[model samples]
Target chain A: MNQYTAQQWRRYTIRVGIYVALLLMTAIFLIPVYVVIVTAFKNPAEINLASTWQLPTELYWQSFSEVMAEFGPRFGNSVQLVIGATILSSIMGSMNGYVLSKWEIPGHKFLFPLMLFGMFIPYQAILIPLFEFMRDIDLYGGIPGLILIHVVYGLPITTLIFRNFYVDIPDEMLEAAAIDGAGFWKLYTDIVFPLSIPGFVVVIIWQFTQIWNEFLFAVTMTSNDAQPITVGLAQLAGGEAVKWNLPMAGAIVAALPPLIVYIVLGRYFIRGLLAGSIKG
Target chain B: MKNNRDRSIAFLMLLPSLILLGIFVYFFIGRAIQSSMTDWGENPAQPPLSETVEISYVGLDNYVRLMTSFTESSFRVSLVNTFFFTIFFVAGCIMVGLFLAILLDQRVAGEGIFRTIFLFPMALSFVVTGTIWRWMLQPRGGVNILPTLIGLDPIDFAWVNSQETWFQFLWQDVPRILTFVGIGILLIMAVRYALNQRWRSMGFVAAAAIVGLLVFMAGAWDYIWPALDVPAAEPTIAPKGFNVALLGVIIAAVWQMSGYTMAMFIAGIRGVAEELREAARVDGASELGVYRYIILPQLNPIILSAMIILGHISLKIFDLVFAMAGPDNAKTIVPGILVYTKGFRANAFASASAVAVIMLFFVAIIIIPYLWTQLRSDDD
Candidate 1:
């Protein structure tokens, strides 16, 4: 009975230790988020009066309202841009990946790595030429241009994700589908596309976060009217004297879509990460 | 005929990525290289469209100037900063990530909550991270003032603006020191491999050490010193050092990435059968020993993949640096910003392309091996 009590005590101590460590880590991780949250809810005057760590006396909607008034239309633009880019890129990547995995042409073995290496090309290296090229092509300063850029860049990782996913599916399934008189697009529409919801989730979430949060291409390619929320938020914060409350509100507003996606579909997001990194 | 039809279908399917990637990625890269060979944009006042503009070939002058000429010190400074940043940032991510993964792997309570909190940063933009960290690390603000609630004096840290440096040294010494560090690591790894009875792997490393020694003696690195264009402006030997101000940036990056590495590690750890660990424990191995000896060996591939990912991110780090320090801050300057500044602000297209090429080399060094291994592994 005494020995049993000692074992129970040890287990209790270990649990307590883990809780302490986890709580401390969680606090560290949450502090920036907390600061952003609290600052966003405070009015400008209250922001000046309170320490950054302190909660607002009362939740004020002024900053949020002001940010909405300024960037509301652009917020819509971000949504359209993200949704359009995500769907287009995910589908393109799915096709590329499916072919790369299941079907092979003469030069595919060479073409595969060439496509994948594009992921590692620093966008800055090609900035000048890309800008000139986009302007030349008449896609430089609009949502369509931004969408095109995202889809192109998003190809590498998305293709990689879907290719790795399809590689794991049993060949017997594809063989059975072929036996049923399915053609190329027919096979995809009936067998692969229907079963690709997981791939869609992974690629969509991946592209959503990437396209939504991307700054360089957005900043360089788009002008004031066409700017994404990232650039808009930076402009909001870049004034002579920064009004902490408003920009914080703008930051949260811009961040909300991805944050919501992550929280709701976090399991799929983690699976995407695992598939991308470990499988590579 | 059926095989040919299927092949045609596959080729047609690949044509979109092919056509697009060709134009944007490959064609543009070729354009950048070609433009880099000329002085098309060098005359900032005369736009390329201007009637009198003379865009002429400059041969390898831009590359030579950026490398050998010390008149443009910013390029060298950014290169050095990138080196230090990559080293520290990758190391920090791996260590913290592995620690968290191990801890969270203990079946802690509220695991889901902790995991979500940790991983959410990966989803946020560098713009947000930079904005928040800039505020938090300000001299009288968030992190520094946290102590005042406990009646302690507020810590005054000039986080993004400080000019202090550590381990200050001449740039000329870098190659020698790097060789030593390289050989040292290889020696340790060789010893480890030897102990594990991996004789062939140990022999390869031993050969590398000998080659490193021979290179060190040959003085080939002497030609690497940047040319002195002017005599009186700065230190004679071209000093290089780590800027303390980048701590905040590193902290923000690590915070964003540790969770990613943690997730990878946790997956790896989960793949290890529980019976293996329990058996180790039953054999009188301590928990630490189980982790160090049994678990880590199994997680090697995961660790390497994490490092490569982190390294790639580090090389292309621009948004965070720009948002945090702005483009003008010399201390936090890196090659990404250098490419932008040289191309746009200075209208030195050739110099920008050279920087881009160098950046590509860094990335290729990390990625080519990865692709090779992955493709080779698939064949088995």
Candidate 2:
């Protein structure tokens, strides 16, 4: 699309030049992806010395398969945490958002701040309290305990996003639903929830990546079979039973769910982040 | 429409998070307040499951121990080392990060390649970064080899010396701190540089190089290449409290995070209004002057936000220390690790909970101001 008169174009090639620069600029963002991918594919000898830029000529299956078999349970642990947290967070986040946005409840502003406090509080500050709470209830080192930890950390932003989005809907819609004798469940699942899918997706992606990659709670809440992959990945020391090739393969395999999400929803990730940050 | 249901619905909606946050975050903090009042680490003879637990109510005992005994131990020395570690680490990252971001922002030749080169740090998990950096920063690694290639003697940095102490003094047994503060300064500078794009375009490479030479010559690199990244101590049972090397751990953590902060700053800069820059120019201000007067003031919010986020990140750093300290090195102590140590290794569940609760309190104090601004700043 260099459609321009030569005389006119010569006078201002700056815009044309800038676009070319941008094409190259875009590649910078993509380089890490390339590096990680290439690292995952290369055989051991070729790993450090091979042109890190070039694609593999032959797909290395052993590393990939070995990592999978070794790390499959670890991933399962992580997935278990992610799945449990996602359902709880989305529902709780949605309900809180809808109620806050639609209702004129007492002390909403003050309560909002109290809720908002959760987002800014660092994970370190809560670990002890969470540890004690989990241990007290005898839920420590299990899926249920981990789910509570995940949801506790997750609520603030998810709640904030859904609240921000719900503000867009008409008060009349909520009022009319109530007038029509719709109860909370009927009103929510039917009226409010459907309208918030895009907002829901945004929260889902944020929560999903967070729980998927989260190491702190994963390491703390569980130690054995219940240990999440993030913990499992960190424990790779290449002992007698441990093969680094498998770990590398496992790391690659472990990285896929989010990596795939990044590839597919790359645009959405940026967009959703922009929406959150710009408003945030 | 009638709505007594509003309050109930609101409470119900808020129920799940409140219960969790209250139990885990708030109520558990109350528990920490209670636990910290007692001595959980003592009375080891009392079985873990004993109902009439013999833990004495040693009021402010841990705080006293934290200030005196714990701080006197290698772990506390490690904590102080973290303080020292953070200063330099934050500086190095900001310097290089701001430099790279601006260089990339200028739209230079092979900019994509360089930008990615800069960002390669972010994709890696801290565990991986720690591993790679260990290879690079180790005295025996390729880094010192570069110096030797240029006719310099091979520097035997303490980083590879398994028994080397980080600090040495002849004074009355003041605890010796072991931290990688020297490299920490460099890393912090790099991060600052990454966050500030204009600094990057200015590419005071000659200045940076001089600084690097000066720093390396000034014994900054000495502490960074510690004597014991691996274990020389016989692998034995994981000990109770205070074995961690906190200083070295915090430094490695700061190195890993500073680059990420740069990306955030870039995002912040993009958020600034371009029209204001044009207006400043129209007012006959020089580019740098315009930036000094207009750009920096606009960037205050982002800078504050970055500091807050970084502070929080710093407090919870476990990955870098864990990787660097190895199994037998008693230097990777933080509340997070302490909790893991207590619950999983020692099976002292109540004590671990207390540590988690205490750490959470510390986190809240740092986070509150930032949260206040975050919630209200949008309206402004």
Best by DockQ: 1
How many clashing pairs does model 1 include? Answer: 0
Can you tell me the CAPRI class of model 2?
acceptable
lDDT minimum window of 10 residues, candidate 2 chain A: A237-246
Task: Give per-residue CA lDDT, model 2, range A1-280, as digits (tens).
Answer: 4556775676467546655655664553443345545556767556532143456667777777666665678778888889999888888888888877777667677677687667655465456556656778899989888987788777877888888888888878877888888776777788888998888887887678668877767776785889877676667632334333344555556566765665555444444444433353
Residue-by-residue lDDT tens digits, candidate 1, B302-361: 899998988888999998887777777888889998887777677667778888877877
Q: Which of the numbered candidates is closest to the native, going by highest lDDT?
A: 1
Once fitted onto the true fold, the runs of candidate 1 whose alpha carbons sit more than 4 angstroms away are A1-4, A278-280, B44-52, B183-218, B224-226, B231-239
Question: Which stretches in model 2 have alpha-carbon errors above 4 Å?
Answer: A1-60, A120-138, A168-191, A238-246, A267-279, B70-72, B92-260, B347-358, B377-380
lDDT of 1 at B65: 72
Top-TM-score structure, candidate number: 1
DockQ of predictions, in order shown: 0.64, 0.30
